[model samples]
Target: MIDGALAPLRILHLEDSDLDAELIEAELENLEHPVVIERVMTRDAFAAAAVADRYDLILADYVLPTFDGVSALGIARAQCPDIPFVFCSGTLGEDLAVEALKNGATDYITKQRLDRMTRTVVRALAEARARADKRAAEAALQALNQTLEARIAERTRELAEANAALQAQIVERERAEEALRLAQRLEAVGQLTSGVAHDFNNLLTVIAGNIEFLERAVLDERSKRRLAMMRGAAARGASLTAQLLAFSRRQRLDPSPVSLNTTVASMRDLLQSSIGGAVRIETMLQPDLWPARVDATQIELVILNLAINARDAMAVGGRLIIETANVAVAAPPTRPERPSPGEYVMISVSDTGTGMPPEVLARVFEPFFTTKEVGKGSGLGLAQVYGFVKQSGGGIRIDTVPGEGTSIKVYLPRDETEADGDDVKPEPVDCAVRHPPGSTPVLLVVDDDAEVREVTATRLVETGYDVREAGSGLQALAFLEADPCIDLIVIDFAMPGMNGAEAATEIRRRWPALPVLFVTGFADTGALAQAGVVGADGIVQKPFRDGELERKVARMLSARQAPGLRLVADRGRRS
Candidate 1:
């Protein structure tokens, strides 16, 4: 999608000559910037244009037979105070030019020196953008402050009410109850964020898919730049949503057995470069470290996050020590509040920096809770680490002293299964998609969202497949029964009735060999596993980039065959 912020610059030109307007358009167009210009000559026309349309810059002649640039500038200032207005005239005195500048004209350019037009227009527009950005930042900060204040006020009121219930029990029960409520509230927020992320991911998918087509269609440098900007923004949004999913513990994880020592040693250069020359990094790896079941990429991220946090805490030079060890957890009174009993692999990050205070420590793992000033940190770093550790069926502990330093220990469940290799990945199926011998591949798209369903089906159709849409799993089954031509099913995991997983389970019971591709947002892995969606091959995360959906579908279809032969390999009955 072309966000207004990144769209072509809209220009309002007040020029009497059609030829001059054309020249200006040609000049601006040749500057390699996307632009749209609307020419208005008469005073009334200028007035109407100023009021009717929003523009980034206004270009006007210094003097016309009937009206003047100053008058038009005044009108523009009154109508669009923030827009940049400049004068391009054939004749104007130095005094008049100074007067024009005093009267709010961004700049004046003589018609003879049209070469300066690009510089003037670019500068004016750049200033306008800077002002708009500053205002936006201020407004966002105000909104964030207001929100934080409101939440604090509400929490205080709730605590006050609890205090009133029993004066003596207030202290003890309040702490306990507050902890309970905090846990419940965080859980609830995680669920809500997960659902919202899902819907948002669906929208992003449609937007990104269309953008891909646009990227291919537009060949000009200017248009490509605009598309590039939009694509970059979309990628950033995807990254942020991924962080939210990680913090919410809904991120789809791919786990395998790997040595933590190897993961840590691999980051030697990255840690040094990221932490800078000021901080010294040391590693203490045990001779025998157990392999733990984990996502190697995520473990790398967790370590990076902790290192960055430690770097931030230490304004001056400090030492960072990363260590790995094997530990057996006992189910005794020792640290009974946590961790349970199990064999685990531990990765510890210790920093000789200013440690967090009690207040900051209390909410350190909470999402969006940060001690650093705004913009320095997202607060999701620790939250993501916490969620990833917990979701991996592991534990995390923080030891800190206010004036001393901090140590964060992450425990990953020890894997009994021997590794085929470090962080071994499943061998992929045949990835060459071919059409059925006698028929074009027919695909079924099941999604509760009409827009998402349409987008998915359209992409498949454009890819040269016969596509069918269903708003529900029941409807999908009905379609499957009506047409025996569906070679693949691309269905959303979260739906109103009979979700993708459930539907896939039912489909499997009826026909076990059919390829089912699960589309989802920050999804519940427990549900998918219970419903029997196979490994990463069967699932695609939401807000997928341009050709991601296509690639996933192609891979799934590559594993399929002609309808009759496919059926023969599975159950005999076809619904």
Candidate 2:
């Protein structure tokens, strides 16, 4: 199928001269694979087209009748971003082209030097398409294998069920064996995805945020339009990072005790709509299954992800079965990779579809491992399921073979006394009253990033607060000392000279009544608490919403005036 092939390269050309466009089109036509070209003579035309969809490469002339290459470059960037852009001009100076490259153009090619133009275009397109194809294939294979494994496991279970009492022990033994194998697979996959997800997510956050910021700064109307394409690419990168984080189990989750039957029943309509009318989804809940502690939303995400994978695996049609049961693990199963014995709630998903080989199975949970074509799958679905289960103190098992179906079983630790289940509800906290609207209360904004500090300070000033800015913890303390009237201090945790904790300690010592809010990207909650910044009045993680920051600051300031609010810093320092 064409879907299995690398995505075709799409090129957009912005040149005032029709000859230049024709030349580029001719060059691309001679490439090995099919090349799609879209041409635009004016900056306005290019801007309008760039936002329609992503292009593999953009070729812009350095000079246009109404606009220059730089202006066109900006428009192309705004509308179809991150795709490589090359300035092809006969009259553009070498120095200017170099400057354009520095300003974010992928490459600058002179018309006389069009010899390498075809090669550059072909190479870039090939790389992009190859990546897209590889990703798609990995997703397809993972889905196929998962479906196959589910069916095989179900068949094995059924055969074991037929023997009744004698086979019961054997079935239990096999289940344990299966779990051990899954654990090993998960551990290996988890280690790899976790590291990649962590680093990749950090980078994505920066890239995506900055790209959006740049999009807003584009001056020309046409250039501004091109930012949308860049934004889309950034958004895709963000989504991929999110998948990686979920698979790595580094994603923040809200866990609760939930009944599989109830949750699935509620989501039936949504699931049915998602899978379409072609594929069948069946639910088989045990008469009295135990409630399991898990993130209900995440569990739903896992189920949906698995079901979508199943649907894809069965290109023609297939049955997807979701079942639940209870088991007691008295001792760790005999399987070499199994967990310690305990009560467990098992949720199994099975499907009948094209299966996978042993080689694919081994790397199934690796991030970016997919069978679908490039740009189709991020290859983090099962890896996410594995990470979620392991992080929540559970286990997962899978069994399958090529051409056969597949079954995946997730085993969560069971609470014996609450086996019958009690009403589970999320309690809502009445968020403290909106910060009393008043003068921005003498706000101090501290951040290592100059841009963040400036923006935040401007925002605060706009809110009517007399804002002071500091680039580091030491600088903040110096500012505070010189101006003791600073009513609120918003500090970034990671800073040179002195960290937020140390600065907070010093601030508290001199100005006991001062309210401090620490912002950080670090995930170590223990470290924050140990530094006497526990509870609602302390630290706020980075990437915070404007309202969250405002509210936290307001609440902390309000708490300072409360007679019973305990000052922990002084007590801790004394102890």
Best by TM-score: 1
lDDT of 2 at 539: 72
* Candidate 2, 194-263: lDDT as tens digits: 6876787788788878877887787887877677777787687777767766766678877665766566
Q: Stretches of candidate 2 above 4 Å error? A: 1-192, 219-221, 330-340, 415-417, 420-575
Best by lDDT: 1
RMSD of each: 35.2, 37.5
Q: Which pairs clash in the backbone of model 1? A: none
**In candidate 1, where is summed lDDT lowest over 10 consecutive residues?**
566-575
Residues forming the 10-long window of minimal summed lDDT in candidate 2: 566-575
lDDT of each: 0.78, 0.70
- Candidate 1 contains a number of clashing pairs equal to 0
